[model samples]
Target: MRKIDLLFAEYGESHQNPTNKFIHWICVPLIFWFILGFISLIPSAHVAVLYYGLISVVSIAAIAVVSLYYLKLS
Candidate 1:
């Protein structure tokens, strides 16, 4: 009944298939890795960063963006 619940229910509707779920399990990580790889290529991405692989400032920025989207949805 709530807007966030409705959003989740709509999203869940398409994921009822087991094959789709399995494909997502594989593709999600691959896509995530691809995104991290892209972000890592940013100029000066390595200098003065107190972090490890896949945990750079750009990745944190991406997380913030996603969190903001969810916050708006909720």
Candidate 2:
């Protein structure tokens, strides 16, 4: 919808700024890590350790890339 698109455009414009974007980049991965860690703690889950490890690695890599992006942007 046009309204949704307009809202997204406004949000995107704010996020396009270097500092706010960098903060989101850092926080998003950290939030994912916490969510994955929480899920891994569930008793009935299979492959919990593997999932935790994979998510951890992904989060680290995402943080690294975000840091590089921030540096370049700044």
Model 2: per-residue Cα lDDT over 4-43, one tens digit each: 6688789898787799889998999898677666654554
Model 2: lowest-lDDT 10 consecutive positions = 45-54
Q: Which candidate is the best by lDDT?
A: 1
lDDT of 2 at 20: 88
lDDT of 1 at 53: 35
Q: What are the Cα lDDT values of the candidates?
A: 0.76, 0.66
What is the clash count for each candidate, in the order shown? 0, 0
Error of 2 at 6 (Å): 4.5
